[model samples]
Target: MPENIVIIGTSGAIGSAFTRRMSALHPASKIHAFSQSSTPTSEGNITYHPICYADEASIQDAASLAAETGPLDTVIVATGLLHEGDIRPEKSLKDLSAKKFMKIFEANTITPSLLAKHFIPKLNRDNKATFAAISARVGSISDNRLGGWYAYRASKAALNMILKNAALETARRNKNAVIIGLHPGTVDTDLSKPFQANVPSGKLFTPDFAATKMLKVLDSLSPQHSGKIFAWDGQEISP
Candidate 1:
């Protein structure tokens, strides 16, 4: 029997790319994709669930729907916020607004954390399971070289912590489950477009390329590797 997968943030570049890849790799598997927009036209093994990452009710509804279907074999959270209009100031910290920082946390950290809290319990314990969150490498305090994007960095860091803690808790009940935080590298998405100029040549990755690498990493993971943070290139990142 094929596995059941739940993909959050299905409208985003990386999320959409994963959906396409998974459709080809696991055609028999049921895929539940959550996005803020209405369902898009696609001929794949996908079920669209309209969900707003910023809304608590929408998150709960999505989780409840997943539970109703059956035990979730895998759940990949691709939701994140790089920029949120003028709410997130383009200027330095001197001009930063608390509201913008909080908004970033809501999207990047709180949203995924809430999903894990509600959905991990719905994962199948009879077999192996995986819960992966798309975190940014900038979230690693030890890896921080240049200082900028404070809100984005802080939010992702919080997400990493939450995923780690969730992994520990989930392990008690589902010993075979693997919870991980993944960084999709500098993909050519709206979130990374503005910052791509600084990226070295041949270092920037397309969403498809990043998704491929991420899937490889996910496939290689085991329960022993749970709670670890990994980059798209398959390298382990500091917490």
Candidate 2:
């Protein structure tokens, strides 16, 4: 039987790219794409659901809708936020606003955590499954050599921790399920456009490329690899 997959954050660049890739590879699979903005234009094998990541009720509703179709084999979360332009002011710890930090936490960490809480339970134990969430390299506490963007970094770190914890818990009840945190590198998207000046050429990947790589990694994962942090290039990253 074809796998059932649900993709969150479907309106973003990477999310849309993953949707297209999955459609091409598994045409018979039931693919549900959830996004916060305008409903994604549907393709032959994909269904779109409007979702608000920051809202718990919206997430629960989306989970309910997804479960109605069938048991999910995979749920990929592609949501992320980087402060773009002057929308967020740059300031040191002493000058940072609590509201700004909370906003970052809501988007980068809390939302995805909620996704895990609601969706992972919907997976079928009879089939091996994977839950992959898009995370950032900056989330690594050990790899934090340059210390700016405190809010973003901390939020992602928290996300990583939660995924790890969830993986451990899931293994007890669903040993065949794999939960992973993936870092997609610096893809060319509105979220990363403002910060790409420092990214080396060729190192900066397109959303399509990143999505393809992420899917490959996800495809390769097994329950043995649960709770690991991996980059788009297939290398394991430090937690």
Candidate 3:
């Protein structure tokens, strides 16, 4: 089990669920949870920290603070963007715009890249370590049968490439380190709420279920698994 864990985007449903599950499962571990919201009163093994995901300086500061405790064994970036006010997934080529693409890419691609830049160096070299970002199966170019969500899909695809790059670079420093992308499988969160109607029966996962399954998958990973994307059922997705 990881002794020192860092979770970015802790204010999200899945992120918060991961924090709760990790704390319960590994009581002796120290979890540094970062989010955009102000730090809350910490309890047990979890400590909350505020962060601005759009700013590199804020990301670096959080990494520094988390590293002060010890070398990080795990860094999970749970940040992503799908829809917000005035911003929704594109339904057709006509809906595409530079503004939408930039906003989506900033949240899905750039944020994870910045996190890896600041946190990957802090991973423990002596033991197995993992850096994971939440990605989606729709990001898989080969699996994309319906290509409607242009920006979201492209952003995740780029994010997957970033994971591959980070994994290769980190290998030269720490051979035991693994950087991967995780597909949480349509969790019932605010990000997916508007699109949940089309989801098949029993396909929607609760935040807790997604968190537990992801932790199980993470526990099963090794350096050889780096640069790949894995689903909640532990199956690899083609990039």
lDDT of 2 at 163: 92
lDDT of each: 0.85, 0.87, 0.94
**Candidate topping TM-score:** 3
Ranking by TM-score: 3, 2, 1
Consecutive 10-residue window with the lowest summed lDDT within model 3: 36-45
Give the TM-scores of the predictions, in the order they appear: 0.94, 0.94, 0.98
lDDT of 1 at 190: 86
Backbone clashes counted, model 3: 0
Model 1 weakest 10-residue run by lDDT: 84-93
Task: Please report the TM-score between candidate 2 and the true structure.
Answer: 0.94
Over the stretch 119-170, how does candidate 1's per-residue lDDT look in tens digits? Answer: 8888889888889999989899998887777888888889989988998998
RMSD of 3: 0.8
- As a whole number from 0 to 100, the lDDT of residue 95 in candidate 3 is 98
Tell me the lDDT of candidate 2: 0.87
lDDT of 3 by residue, 1-239 (tens): 78999988889999999999999999999999999995765788999989998789999999999999999999999999999899999999999999999999999999899999999999999999999999999999999998899999999999999999989988987999999999999999999999999999999999999999999999999999999999998999999
On TM-score, the stronger of 2 and 3 is: 3
